[model samples]
Target chain A: MEDDYYSIESILAENQKIQCTFKIDVPDMGHLDGGNERDIKALSKVQVPLWMAYILIYSDYADFTIPPPFSARVRSALNAEARSVRLSNLVGQAGLWYGFGRMIMRLLNDDVAKEMSDVLVKTFRDRLPEVIDQAQHFASVHASSADSGVGGDNATMLFREGLDGTERELFALAQDSTRRTKRWYETSERGRRS
Target chain B: MALPTPLRASVTPAELELIASEQLVEIVPLVAMERTAFISGAYGPLRPPTKCKVPIWMATNLKLKKKCRVVPPDWLNVEFLEGRLTQETSEAGFSEMPFRFAEVAKVLLDVAPDDFPNPDKIRSLLKDIREARQAKSREGLSKLDHSELSLPNLCSMEINEIRPFFIRAMGVLTDLVKEAQPQQDAP
Candidate 1:
């Protein structure tokens, strides 16, 4: 699904950078590293966009390392408590952590790919319940406050700030449904009064 | 411009309520009337003080004009809803309810609160039941997997509330699963 051409999320995920170590000397591509050198030296590391890295890595031009978002520290942190990790901060500004991880998984070999994919799935599964709870909580809070804005305590705001793109979408969906249900309840009561 | 949020694929609570209005309800007529025909079906030869089975929309229309009294469905009472609430809180799964129970109950309680005994208590009981069920749904979602999730006896309104979340979550799961499969096959 991340491969969908029309999906803006997928596009942003592809635009994310992946650090690759060059296996062959490539002239004129030193600009990728923002260096003045005319040729990218063999064994030199350079950060390339995920989309371009996919081709270069497959065509035997480079070998990419796991990006900082999926590093061992993040892995253990996720294992410790998946809900507390701030996924939005992990993937820089776009906050497409899951999508970026999936794209990176596609570029890896078998055993490592399986491990990375499992992390993505487990993190998403672990955090989903909390995401949904906050959405419903905010929905009711929004309803009762009656245009007082999307009101919630500091904890909820802090938690919401941690959501990745996919979880953000799910949160929006759940909040919307709850709001509609609240509106329906109110209108039904109005119908009774009239 | 894109379609409004509620109009996108999933059914809204209001739309579900409209559909629930088609359900047949028993009403006590104040004035006699001949059988009437409509697209859905023909409903009845209502007689004074005599009961007739008509769709809820017609019942609401007649009740609004002071022509009839709606007979609340059997399960709308506080006693029955309280029983369901106990079952919902005690059980791990959902209790069986009328397929459109939420929508129908809201419509009935809205259009004809006077017909039911102790409408306030019933309303509060229904709210309690809903909260219990929602808690169960969240628990179910916590165990969600890429393969399947079975939540039997969920009513229409409950299903609609979680539909979008479930669909998108499953989509992501499928993507993850599909990515993992080829790796296992290759090695």
Candidate 2:
């Protein structure tokens, strides 16, 4: 867990250096309820670092050469699609990473963002099992409540369960988010060819 | 490319069944129709007959066969498989299909009178099916331990293979919607 934490922090540091060169004010974090604001803020702040990492990683996948005319045309079409889809504003270097993370969390489960916060904290503390156990317990409790058909305060319980160990949730979120981002990038590439 | 003539009459369930059957035959292979199935309403049941089955093995087999390399399981229906040969399967996966359909549907639904139920529901249902397929895929992937050397590449290969089928499915769906469209001048 300590190693994981160190790696994550290092990634964050590298990302900050790469991405924050052209800094923009972080957008409004939006409405967070049920003690979720804390977690949201934490996740939001990490976007800066994540974007930095993305630039480095994406470069590994493809060279940053100036796109040819076809690619430029495709990029323009994608930009139009993004605008129509409301993705233009949602995507920037950092904003894109953050949006990707949020979309992953939403797809996995609504409470994922909060859970990731817990995972990051646990990773820092080097208590992987404890985090896992807590998450398991929370999942168990929520399962029971759901089975009983009692909808009582399950949101917090689920959040607690999700947040229980290490940065598993964050890692999952990042993986899915990256996948989606790649899809968008590919779509633009295709638009250029078409 | 020329669009098909607009379907003037409301499709009877019987017509829908026939269309579904024709679609199945055109898209998927000639497997015997199973006992339990759902036929589309566009082609009436008496028409050709579109048979719907859980095709679980077919989905799984596609990954192993290497015919498809990148599509997810939900997109691996018989109809989708047919479309992949001509279309670039990677670009036409189930995910992209619904996204495109939804975009078109939104426009149609918006201009459509208030009485009409949104076509978005169909897109949603398609997405649900895709997710269910993904869940099955996750279960299958779990059986293969992460420690294996070839696991990562194998998983990606499977996904790539499945992508074409999804693209084919999207093409079929687009065809269906276009076929069902009212004439441009009609009310």
Interface RMSD of 1: 3.4
Best-fitting candidate, scored by TM-score = 1
Instruction: Report the Cα lDDT for residue A93, model 2.
Output: 24
Docking model 2 quality class: incorrect
User: Model 1: per-residue lDDT, tens digit, B1-187?
Assistant: 2988545848888788889989999999998999989899999999888889999888888988889999888888988899999999898889989999988888888778899989999999999998898888888898898878989998888888888888788888877753535642231
lDDT of 2 at A87: 21
Stretches of model 1 off by over 4 angstroms after superposition: A146-155, A189-194, B178-187
RMSD of each: 2.4, 24.5
After TM-score superposition, what is the CA distance of residue B130 in candidate 2 from its true location, in Å? 5.2
For A6-60, candidate 1 gives per-residue lDDT tens digits of 9898998888998999999998877888889889999999999998997788788
